[model samples]
Target: MAPEARIKILLKNGATALCAGLVALSSFSLGAEAARRHYRGHHHHIPQVPAAPPRALPYPQLPLPFEISGAQYLPLAWTDVKGWSDDNHLAAYKTFRASCKSINGQTGASEPKALGGSLSEPCRVAKTLELSDDAKAKTFFEDNFAPLRISRLGEPDGFVTGYYEPVLEGSRTQTDVFNVPVYRRPSNLFVRGYKQDSVSLPNKGPVYRKIGRRKLVPYYDRGEIEDGKIAGRGLEIAWLKDPTDLLFAQIQGSARIKFDDGGVVRLNYDAYNGYPYTAVGRVLIERGIVPKEEMSMQRIREWMAQNPDGAKELRRQNRSYIFFREVNLSDKDEAVGAQGIPLTAGRSIAVDKALHVYGTPFFIEGELPIDSERSKTPFHRLMIAQDTGSAIIGPARADLYFGAGQEAGRVSGRLRHPMHFVMLVPKGLDPSVRAAKLPVPDPRPSEKIAKLFPQTDPAKAGTPAAAAAPGKNETVATAGPVPLPVPRPAIEPAREPRRPVKNRSHRQQ
Candidate 1:
């Protein structure tokens, strides 16, 4: 009697407890965070501030009262790009298909011309992007845009009319991280490789007198300086997974000194002097700077030391140092511990001005992959709308900031690719923006040289020679006499003129 009755009693008690628990759980917040998370990206994009420079410039270390008098910041003068200006990125097409369903109001498909000739994320047929209702915009953004521009950077058509502010996660002396949900996906790659990998600042004290400037200090020229030894003027590009220690080593010209006991160690001096918001790391593996099938950090040290002749600074001409601020632990004097950037040093992303205006959202499509090992792609990037770098003087060019520290260094250094970009300009804004003013066309070389050379100077130039026969290229010799329009016979002149010898013969006969 007790066993059968016990089972029935237990069942009754279990049912009552379950009912009580359900009553408690239902009273809590109703998907409050989950419901509103999608709207986080609306108010994040900030237009260029009054304090922001016209062009994002790299910060370099110079001596006290750094007399950079002759230094001139180059302006954006880009003009042409071969492809991707219209519909180059593959992603733009996909974005339109995904976003158009909701944005079209009535759904079918739009003609390609309506898409503004691009394939950016949330690429509603450029014709169909009219935001008549909230539902369409939300749906169009959700499918294509959320992945690229919505939560990343650049104010996609209507994010800011909603409420949100970027949340910074560090103090002034620390590396501040501003996190946003909406960001752009890169499409076109307009990387300008430095003609030479690096250059040094020209110390002009000695040469100043020659140029009629007496009060000169150390200076660099974007064009010309008399001194040949001063090095380069701007940022040098290198790929690295971790650039912290490497940066320190570069400035110090020595390897990072780790203790034999495998504990903490430090260097004595401002190894980071002149470099701001930048961190150093021992990046020897990822960049292929030191090639190896399987090399450890220790082996990397050995390789650098053994090959002391190896690229010590690994510097190049025409490339400059990209500077940012870093937060260092107070254990050492001015030793940067974590690199945080308030302002990045290059204008890697920009609007076509003629197409997508500044502050417009875009998605870039290309093959340069992001490393999930350190950071992943779907970069969730932002376009500050800053202008070109000195290296990016060409109109169709973009100076991609590899970012600060080692991880960014690696991604940036390895970032050699051809890409196409697609973006949304502020709707109704004219795509005919004459943003980057005009320049006279480059002169034809033959005409330019004709005026300058006047049939002299050996007809020499930097141009390559012609194919002499097939596969052979010895420069054509132009030393022979100019060919004549008509042939001239090589006959000797007659010595005597017609004479009166016949008159003398008549008298003698």
Candidate 2:
């Protein structure tokens, strides 16, 4: 379990996986071709059947260059209210999910003009709704969806999910891969959700919230599972071997949009997540990637035809889907000064660039008063920002993704306290915004960690920390006064590059 050994192993596995994927790609031809199927997870008793097998989701997949260990998450507020089941209503949900997909250009031309609304001008049409993937998704929407505008066919109930290549991606390269930014337009249904407190917008800007069951059970992929911990539930996910771009669309809400432009107005959710898919499609269309009337689906194919690399990303985006119930983490404890990994669960805050960007190495020196259901308690120490959630949106505000079960639920429900904390940003970033700088008197003459642990030579400590230990996040390699490992690229060669080979001892000859 030494750090160097771990790093070497991680290096070996990663290199091997990359080589395998590259080899697979070279051998098998990849494309838009696919068969669609009705998936009923392992628990479903139904026979497996394919209605239309998806060649793949429409967005392309461009893998991130390096592994993202942990970044603090701002969380949203949501919980499954009362009774909800997907088994009974899947057929109905399929219809709605299908309708939204079809209407939003999942498979056809996105009808920007449909339903009388546009991002520039609040469309007067009924807001769209998306049923969940489960059988009941459709039925639930039918019962709960409330639309302001009547559907062209009849009446609409608000419940539409817009699927777009998160603008950060549709527009740039290093995309917010998991983020679905554009749920751009919110109809009256959304207004209702916001107003009734069915949904809560975090006071802080755009950080994410942890989606959890009422009990804050953490969601973990099998590989990340620890023996005694319970894993969380969410959309099943997988990484496509090849990068690809797929279908994208926008499903609007009922709130009437008021554009800052003012000439025409429609309610699109303030680009909270990002622009709606419909909005992005319009922008892309205006740019002439495809005709205004061309189905965005096929156009995506055409776009891929023209931009081969992009084609992969488009497909990748479409194939993936997620469902979340953001929770509040108010009751947990905070550890300061000690080297530790943070849980995506528990209360958290986001800072602006002036303060600290996500992923700052954190150190809390003073007491962080806990809002206990019982009595006051102070817990603080060193913890790395591991994840960011949806509710944490603003530069100052943040969602507290509550970690697990009834206990976490009860504690998180009431958590809110101010604590003195400090952070270490990627060097050169202004630190005033994070927390007042921590003081370290100049490396006093001969003051080194070697003085603390004489047997653990500083020279031996210089070896790369092993990255092979996949389950543990990072080994806190400290050289004494430096409690946390400075994120030195030089120190992490496994994640970066190998050092130069040492020359043989010529004197030995």
Candidate 3:
């Protein structure tokens, strides 16, 4: 009878035990045959039995809610977000719409590699909706996106600092009082590892200067530039009163240069000196020059003013320098961000571009010292990732952009705090569905292959018998204990004979 027919017959007759016994006998026979061949020295090649394929899982393995480098994401409901309902969604929606313009422009090959095409559907839906009502705007976000608590992988909370457009009095041309020059990008400056004469500078990379036809060196640092290294190169766009104002403007990345004749020139970040940013405020704290609680832009300015030489020394410690380019904007317009659009004060935030998309929305909840230096006002709002800064790194780090002037600076300067971060991921990238489809991992081979290999008992690991067992590289004699040599006693026969002879001579005398 055929194997199938026999199997059916056994099942019909209820001979399941006999069938299992036959399978066991067959496995034992195969194993015995291989051992016999080895003992007989037949030298016949024993064919390797391929391992059995892993059994299929009844359910798929679950996956994390989202994937962001250096970050972990936990799925959350909209209700879980603190103060979500009270936030001004309309304002956030407007900023989101502005970023969507840039997002929509990136299609086909121009899509961002990090986020890919995940955000396109949401951007399309946003463009079709004319959301005037705040309730409708909130509904749109709820329907199209999912909220996830995002933070740095090992960190428990997110951190935020603040920046603003510094308005400093200046002149278009260098004058006696307004002598410190605010420089434009130098002609010789280029990104390192690229052609020196390239038409445009890349958005990201270390920048360098072409010394000659074949040599490239780091671009002039803040100290070198301040000391007039590139003075006669006609790189000055405007002139500020002191180096202190210029340094602050560089830290902010943009400034409104107001002339004595009432003309205002807008200068935005063009390039940088390719050195790592060192926060002067942090240095002050480290050196015990400024207390951590009193470390703010206003305080730093006061300290700098009191000690001019120390200020210059502190400024030189931050070697990274920023170059500016003129932007055509009216006096009423807010300062533009790295996204090439005018920023929304209190709504726009600069996030780590390496880890997040520009158009992403984040809901931040925390108490901040906004009202006063020591006041803790609740700061719960929806913020848009519309810009980036060198200092703003990591998945959960952000820099909040306030508007221009002294009041804006005061509020922004005192805003370094920890907060809760909830990222709004679009519905297109459904993490739950993706997680459900993930396959379970294969089982370990320890149980299946255990009998074929020699096993060692954990309880006898350090015993003499276990230690005496030869390893792959050891011989039996080498692995066993070695006998120690015994020392011999010293002889004293010659001294005893000499003492006996002396006693005999004394007796004869």
Candidate 4:
């Protein structure tokens, strides 16, 4: 009787406890739902779902200024090049032959690695061959080499501008009419190449010029020079009537100065203060001083004349400054380029020397200004790279020489258009083939990732994560990397030893 009663009592107590627990759990669930609904009603802006973490992207590759300047070459057939046959190759040959002298003179390990030894044989052939006409000269080039289109990485077309030797009327001494003074290179200025953390200025690479030896400081800018910073140092080369003419002469880097008498003096670029060149035309456009469509040298000059008050300040906005040395005005002297060779009027071109060889030939086909107003003129000529300029930065970029004098200045100023440039590479030296020989950087981003985060264990980092499947061989073309064109030193013509000038202000006309 006692066993049956105890079992029944235990079953009843367990049922009651289970029902109470279930009721408590239901009440808690209901309260939580009500609280969540109340919070949502009160806070209307907050999102209900939590945001996911952002995925990490691969670290980008950043190259130094030098690494990017590598010349990227793409090969093309001779027939593929436009207007190849019709060009006056005799003119190009004459210029090329002149360049050969410079090429032949360079010996030992100092030769340009880009051209290798290919230029030697072609240069020998150029010296002896006297082509009677353009037809024979064209045949010589066709037999010697193939054409390869050159460009910087990621960019397609190269820009070609025009530069000319400007002629100006001036006097040897400062008078009321001729007061502006041109300075010579300062003796104290020193250039320091690339530094990891620049000692003097921000991001100061290899091209920064400093002042003084005891206490090195940044060199004087254009404004300082105009303000008479180096005025008393006996640096005056010549004095001109118009300060604008002086500025233009500085920009051009060379000028023929006609004295009041029959005599003339040729001034060539010597050195520069380290500040980078900022285009004055760009400043005018930005300040709304002149409309972009009407922006030309003549137009800019007119605007400056009209705005007399702001002219000096406008010119000062460009920080770059150029110094000059006296060059002989002989028939053979002509206007020499940066390569120290006599520049042929129509045949010589100034290219990015950092990315190209001195004697390299490029066939440029673009519309130029042949007429007075400079509307449009067909230009398809083979240009020899005999010169270089600071602004000429890219692989395909070039500055075409348009001879000397005022008319040449007018035509040259009008040429600021894009052109198709094809480089005449020596025969058998294909750029693609040459590029294949060079080393390629690791393409796998993960390999770089390990390098970026060296603290992580190699075992934990896993095998080099690739962009493709495992064991797949991927090849990257190292022909040329994209380069940021850092400006070079001022273009200075090699001149004869400096001689004492006869100081005569009263002897002039």
Candidate 5:
């Protein structure tokens, strides 16, 4: 037979086998249900049988949220979102289209694990439609997806912070004014528990440095690096004005370097040391140096300026250090995010990548201190998940990206508040279906097991005789099954007796 004919035959056989297996699975489920019914009919006198739970709906209904994988999702109508009708959907749609460039590149088998290939159909439809008006763009999302109120299992609302691109004055070489160096990723750095030259490193894990051939050790921390460790290694990317500029840039993950010769250098996060990140602002609040209500990035900067020695000590409290790599971007362009796309100011957000996909749309509604530190204004808008950060963890935590410059930095630094998170999930991946598929817990123990473990006699239950403690010479009767002993209340231990002190002063005199 020809090779093409053999290949076709193999494909046909595989399809047939898949169909057969599905049919068998359906039959097995039906048989199990029938057996359950027959048992219930014959054993109607079994008092230990539990009542049936309410059946799950085929589609999500109102008022009851479904839970999956430690997150709760409450399906809602589009009108339920607070200011959905008034927001500019066109801007969000444009950002979504940009993210689709990355999403569409993925094959179905390699699609994001959180989305489970459900976004493929939505991306295809979005590409085919050329929407011009905000109304049409809004309709497109409404037609293709369902909005779900998402939160962590125990949290009441999602948290939102803001980040911005820090533009700082710097120099290419170490000068008198710009002496603090920004280092690039070291050649010896590697992911922990992996070979030195691993082609693919996992998204989440500790990183380490390799010495010689086989010995692996932790990378240099912030203090060691600040003390001039690993210097003269040809890893300097640029030199900033002071340590404060470099620290803030590291916290924000990216920065633009402005030089005196009318030149610009863009740097993006490349790697980090294995140590965990400790926020210095939180440390200040814990030590009562800064009040929690008045804490902000600007405040930290001002404090650092006034107390340089204390600032150095504060910086060393956070041991994690960041490395950067130069990117080729014009001054007019925005910074590229972890999603490999230019982030749209006010429209892009960094989410917990482990719990959410990059291209997912979220409708946020809240009041924020946008105008002043104490003033609150309504903030309702749609945002796209285009980035991820080390601090952005949990199902409901996010970081909103603001644009560049000092004003943007000021606004972003003051943005930290709780907000409502409504995720627009594709209809193909139904939350109702996922909830229904969860295995029902086993019913109460059967009558035979209950009989084997009989309950205490009600007549003797909680009586004085049953509750009384036995004396040392008492002989307790064990005529019938022994009842469980009643627990005694906890008693405080006896205190030590006071002793008289000697008159050491009189003896010295």
Candidate 6:
């Protein structure tokens, strides 16, 4: 054959082989792409890759006048919630449902204390269920809500105090025996801007009284009120025997008045004098009179009895004063709290209404130093935010209600333990809405993101790009950069174990 013809035939065969290989490679790529799309569309039956443990995120701190300062939180998984499975959620469910009437009915401007519009769906879901057993209630709560562990600044624990409804011996009219006067909301007392003030604390709104023609001034303190300031106003509700009992009763916010004739009446918190609350127990601790670990209301009362001469001055140390309104206790044995609902014995808790809404569920774990055998025992349960107090200041702080009478008082007065708090917000409502209220800067910015998207302005690099990274947990917002979702780890397929071959040649060998 000719040399030119042979070279042309070799070139033609090589070209054909190259074209066949390219067609096969393109077909294989297309097949792989189709399989991936199919897998994404139908993934329900397939087992999901186990999620990595949730990383702690920086929660925003309150910045407004109404917000509790320095209070923050972090998102935690259900497994992170201690004693979650052990709690009797049915008891909590009962307490929560009691506040639903008030919560669901609530309208107008959203108040800080009660469940407003956000709780409507959860409340409705609760109303439909029978919730007869503990298991069902537990499941309901777990399915409906996610837990957020609350902290102050960065610390996970805070002080847990206790308060209770007191039962006092009193008379409607002032007598020789019953001389101490329990005053009503004075007629002369006025609030700033409004003709009458309805808010219970100074922080909620400014409280004032009309002194001159049009001038408004802060209402009188405990000292002035005890003197002659509210003297001839005909505002006295009832008179009690002991002055110390009246003082403690004011701090507790409610009292059941028992008469010699065996009849009883209730007095609930109506108004305050706008003065900041000073805990006398705290006063004793600061003065070095009583050690903080040993200080309790029972001990304070005993100290006051021992030194009657200085009792008057010590009682006056707390400038905050409480006024009461006569409430009928015919319907229920327990006193109605600030939420206008009957407070449960161990289930109710008093928090700063300015910080938390009423009917909100809080899971607390702490040890209470009550007088009974159960004192200094671990208490892990779900409690409802039923009331508010002057001294309940922070987001982590709470005053647990120990029911009524002397036993309740004994338990309540002695409790001064550190507690862990986990707030349960309603499901479906974006918790980021609350977090967005006060945008917190990321404490530890992403070093990887910062280096990748290096900022021209050195100052802005940590503040912007590093914060916007997904796993780094930046504050959620509409305007800021949307974080790219973290890619999940690829899962390998399962393989069958190989069976070893049997050795049958030993006898023949």
Ranking 1 against 5 by lDDT, winner: 5
**Model 3 superposed RMSD (Cα):** 20.1
**lDDT values of the candidates?**
0.31, 0.30, 0.83, 0.75, 0.84, 0.79
Write down the RMSD of all candidates, one decimal each: 40.8, 34.7, 20.1, 27.9, 24.0, 24.9
Instruction: Name the candidate, 3 or 6, with the larger TM-score value.
Output: 3
Q: How are the candidates ranked when ordered by lDDT, highest leading?
A: 5, 3, 6, 4, 1, 2
Residue 438 in model 2: lDDT: 41
Q: Cα deviation of 185 in candidate 1 (Å)? A: 34
**Residues 323-402, candidate 2, lDDT per residue (tens digit)?**
22212222222211001122332322222222222333232322222354445554433222323322222222222333
lDDT of 4 by residue, 1-509 (tens): 69999999999999999999999999999999999889888987565686786764454343221222545656788888888887889989999998898888887874444665567678888889987798889988887877887666666767877888988988888889988898876666666553423222211222334433445777778888888888878888889987788878877778989997888888876666766667788898898977777677777788788886688888898777877878776467589777777889889998766667788889998676667544777788899999765566777888888889888887777667778888887775655555555555667887875455444333644555523344558563322233448989798898999999988798659
Candidate 1 C-alpha lDDT tens digits along 146-243: 22111112222211100001111221111223111110111110112311112221111121111232343322321122132222322111112223
Candidate 1 stretches greater than 4 Å from native? 1-306, 313-361, 372-389, 399-410, 427-429, 432-509
Model number with the top lDDT: 5
In model 5, the clashing pairs are none
- Sliding window of 10 residues with minimal summed lDDT for model 6: 60-69
Give the per-residue Cα lDDT of candidate 1 at 137. 41
Give me the displacement of residue 313 in model 5, in angstroms.
Answer: 0.7
What's the TM-score of each model vs. the native? 0.26, 0.20, 0.73, 0.68, 0.72, 0.70
Question: On residues 1-509, what C-alpha lDDT tens digit does candidate 6 reach at each position?
Answer: 99999999999999999999999999999999888778877864566889997876665345342234577776677788888887889999999998887888877876544234566677788888877999999988887776877867778696787788888899888889998899998876776655564645343454678877788788899888888688767988888998899999998989989888898889888878888888888888899998887787888999898987778898789888888888877366788988888999899998877677788888997666654533677678899988987777788888889899888888888877788898887765445555456765664558766655544444665786745656665653323444669999899988879899887776755
Q: Pick the candidate with the highest TM-score.
A: 3
Q: Evaluate model 3: give its TM-score.
A: 0.73
Candidate 5 per-residue lDDT, tens place, 72-96, comes to 6687888889999989999999999
